[model samples]
Target: MVQVAGMNSMWSLILQGDAMTKCILIFLVGMSVLCWSIALYKLVLFSIKNKQLNQVVQELQSVQDFKNLFAVAKKHAKTLPGYFLSQSLRHFKELLLLKKSGKQEYAQGAGIDFLQMQMNQSIDEILHQEESHVSTLSLFAAVSPLLGLLGTVWGLVHSFLSISQKQSADIVTVAPGIAEALITTIAGLLIAIPALMLYSFVSSKVREIEFQLYILSDKMITIARKVIVEDLISVEFDENFMHDQLDRE
Candidate 1:
């Protein structure tokens, strides 16, 4: 009833606006749609990833050895933590092979440093993948308001021109221009506010994900150091034993 009539009147007012105003309205509508779409998609993605991360972290915490960690990571390979663990394990194996092949230069301090660098790179790549398209939301937030302001200025100029041409400042002559100006301004605010809010929310979530990744990376580094140290010690002991046997012969 009253709501329907109001809705019809609002549409009629928008229709009566100038071409520029109409175009601005259409652009704003499209931007609003895009903003909501990105927000919804990111929200769902972050929610799922966060859940997976928590589960993997819990499982990882219980792991006492690298073998068990690698196995647990294999089962959750689709998740961020799992991907990191898998990559770390791969590098670990490569380092072990180098050590066994008598590449002492690489198997000692240099090897651990190389593994740490690889793990850091892995974390960065995963973070980038998780944070894709978030910048678009920030861009929309900044641009929507400017576009709305452009529409508002255009409408005001038209209103003044109409008043001058008609030689009358009557309510009838002024109302349409004022309506057009306000509509575009309001539309812009609507688009900008939600976009800004969603951008903030998504950015915070990305930071949280990054923090978790850093924690996991630190834990992996600790494990890598321990494994490399033990391997080096075993190699040194084997070499000493062989030398003693050769001397006795």
Candidate 2:
């Protein structure tokens, strides 16, 4: 194949390059590998979590009361909303107990504040869990280009030194170093271009996820506050519902 010959020719050219060129190329390649690996991992992770979040949100839509919502939340305890709901419900129960102890006024004000605080902490935990390795992608995008530029500068300096030693200027003498410079520049761009794109893409995805979580938190806090302060029915955990949900899962 023509492609095979081109490949061999490129490989030979790379082999002909000096030690610095080789190292730069290798470092660029490694960054590219790591960048792509993180991209793939983030893509898969967000995809799965997004699907799960959507499913939970959809199920929550059909929930009419605190008890049913609590049942659903317990069913998907490992999910984002599920975990947050569990934390919220614990404070909800505490508020109820305090109210029964003749602390109704305190429960109305302090209870809602405490629940929101717990949910905020839960949101941070979720974001931290989902945002792993995103910074690494951005770092590689920034660092790769600089490394490539370093190689190019080194190659140019080497060529000038070579000319001084040989006391001549010609294509044959200059071509190898020029090619090495070009190769590093090309390698840097290759790594940087995709890395920048991946960084932007994953970063946007995370922002969107965070936005959704905030909206969901607001709605949950509003509903929970009403249920607590207005003495409305609250989510009551049910063992039979849990068993049924698990069976469906």
Q: Which candidate wins on lDDT?
A: 1
Report backbone clashes per prediction: 0, 2
Clashing pairs in 1: none
Write candidate 2's Cα lDDT for 1-249 as tens digits: 999997787788789778989999998998899899999999888877777677777777766567776776777877666665666566567777777788878878987788778778878887888889999988988988899899889889988899889998899888876776778888998999999999999988887777767766776777776776887875455656445444542
Looking at model 2, report the run of 10 residues with the lowest lDDT sum: 240-249
Q: What is the lDDT, from 0 to 100, of the residue 61 in candidate 2? A: 73
Best by TM-score: 2
Error of 2 at 227 (Å): 1.7
